[model samples]
Target chain A: MASAERIGIRSDRDILLARQRGRELGRSVGFVATDLTLIATAISELARNIVLYAREGVIELRVVTEDSHRGLVIVARDHGPGIVDVNRAMQDGYSTSGGLGLGLPGVKRLMDGFEIHSRAGRGTTVQIAKWLRT
Target chain B: MDVPVLKQGPFLIATVQSALTDADLAQMRRLLIEQVGKFRSRGVIVDVTAVDVLDSYACRTLRDIAHMTGFRGAATVIVGIHPELAFTMVQLGLSLEGVATALDLEEGLAYLNARTRPTIARGNSPRNSAGPPRNGTHTRGKR
Candidate 1:
């Protein structure tokens, strides 16, 4: 676990900017289209989720390397009404509202490592990690 | 942003390459308006297969295409949206509202073909003018 560079995107404009930043960071770490797409998608979903669901949130990106293996970790946390049932939400095709239900769960599946913690009436925190080839 | 043309039967199939980002949205919106001005097309089948995501901006652009094409006596259909991507959108609570979506490319073209049926409009200009410019409909939906 290493320190991550974090940013806040309160407005929709910031979301696009953040994604561009993520892309630059991803490239420096040797991420290809597949990895870039997954990271970009995950970041977009998380950032959009924050803009839509919470007052605001933070996006954190960190570089992780060990044994010649390089990877990136992304964590998004929102201080909104926490999810009551994280498990139920993780279930594919389960959506609270109308659109596709792939936001959180989709990001989880796309990443190499995923962890989420949310308490009712509290806030929700999602962390995702993806590996990069040297 | 690149607009690649694939010739289908009796119609030009325009596939928008790259993600339907703010830039592409702007371009598509312009083309749609231009198409309406020219009034010379059977219909257009938009293949979004290469696109993995469509934001609110893209959604607005799609809506614009559907509306503008309707006025031009042509129709548009969106196809190849990944199920997972669709699912995520649903969760995000974004709505394309009336824009048609197909499971695959073939299905999308068929839907557009079926809707080539004509509809009339008095004049053609952009509607839903309140939102900020998205894809470079500059000073309007400009990105």
Candidate 2:
């Protein structure tokens, strides 16, 4: 089990750093250019969620290696007002800010694995992984 | 720093430099609209070739910026999107709805230029000219 590297998501600039770090980590884990960009964009969306929804948060990047499988994992954690409705939030065109509301759905489509946990008043944590083997 | 909205002839070119902070993004948006109003420019070319990342906010802002430019009667072209970013954006479901994109800065400028030039005066565009198409993308049908 590889230890995760943490990147803070406090501002827009922080999202840029998170994306860069995610891309670099994805590249090191043997991801193709397309996969690298996907991983980075996923991080960017998640990190911006922290800044936009919650005030701030953290992103943890780790590599997954199991037997013959290798992958990149991302964990986004935010301790802000949690989503009241996960189902509605995941809808493609649902946005509270007059946006296209493509963040959550798009992130899901990019990664090989996705999961989310949240408590109304507590916070939210989203974990995503992209496998290189298959 | 002021995001330079340069004027070349009748159009405007806004190049986003690196390390743009949240406040900087706001400033650029404000200044871009201001410059468009001040110069009454016909079209705008937003060059993001130097940009490496496109977050959710960045994506939404871009789409919104293009819309805003349209409201001012100025056509907009987004250029220099990294190939990877474009691919990822498509996966992200960010249709950008009504945005026009180009491969590079030159293509963007040419697209905008070709858009504003006298359309009917060219005598059917020489269908077989040796030169590159005046419109790189965003052609014929118009957004």
Candidate 3:
């Protein structure tokens, strides 16, 4: 899936803009209200993760179609302190810092597909996809 | 800048103007607690009618604000959560247990009124007798 839209997640304003863009693209892909929320909320979660942990990142949303399955794909990339324990990060209520640990796991539950790549000191990237008929 | 606050009798109504970032969220929390204290209000209505998305951070901020205000003896009610946004928030594993929700601003005010003095009984059936809801227009019948 090629990049349909690219958003830089640097500040609070960028996160907001990313949400708006994600919502629009979701709508363009014929996602209903709940699915739209899923798309936009996922983007916000990823962007906020960057701002909170890495301090900056990039969000890429793409339109993907395979056979008869059509879905929207979102990729969030951040170049900050990467996650040392990917499996632990995916667990519910397992936040590195002292807060409700619902960010990554929540995203995984919302999307139809999810993948995470990270390094200890390099960066991290999260990719998620939501289908229309699912 | 602080989120806009409108004083209504003993209740303070804070309409979130737009999607908030981390810094703005912190600032808004400070201002809201301060306003709640300064007004000595009994209830606070956080109208999130203009917001399009409620992320994890936003949900946490709202919950924290509710807790802090509750510490100050003010009841907080969140009003006008876009239906889609609400559905998604719940799906994202956000319960928002500390904060209460209403259909619109009017209902939020009425909810606070009903809970504050505990004298006038509130209406059970929701009418939603107001203009169109703001922001994405996803205000459905009830929560």
Which segments of candidate 1 are over 4 A away from where they belong? A1-4, B1-42, B45-73, B77-143
lDDT per residue (tens digit) for residues B68-141 in model 1: 77677666777777765576455445567777778877887677666653321222134624554455343322
Lowest lDDT 10-residue stretch of candidate 2 chain B: B120-129
Q: Tell me the spans in candidate 3 whose CA falls farther than 4 Å from its real position.
A: A1-3, B118-143
lDDT of each: 0.69, 0.82, 0.85
Give me the iRMSD of candidate 1, please: 5.7
Name the best candidate (by DockQ): 3
lDDT of 3 by residue, B1-143 (tens): 46888998999998888777778888888888998989898888888888878888888889988999999989999898988888888889988896888999989988887788533223221332254444544333343
> Candidate 3's error at A89, in angstroms?
0.8
Candidate 3 interface RMSD (Å): 1.4
Q: Compose the digit string of candidate 3's lDDT tens values, residues A28-100.
A: 8889888888888898888888888999889998988988999899999998999999999999999987768
Off by over 4 Å in 2: A1-3, B17-22, B118-143
Each candidate's TM vs. the true structure? 0.60, 0.83, 0.85
Clashing pairs in 3: none
Which stretch of 10 consecutive residues in model 2 chain A shows the poorest summed lDDT?
A1-10
lDDT of 2 by residue, A1-134 (tens): 23468998898788888888888888888899888878988988898889988979999999889788899889999999998899888889887767668889889999999999988989999999999966
Q: Score candidate 2 by TM-score against the native.
A: 0.83
Sort the candidates on lDDT, descending order.
Answer: 3, 2, 1
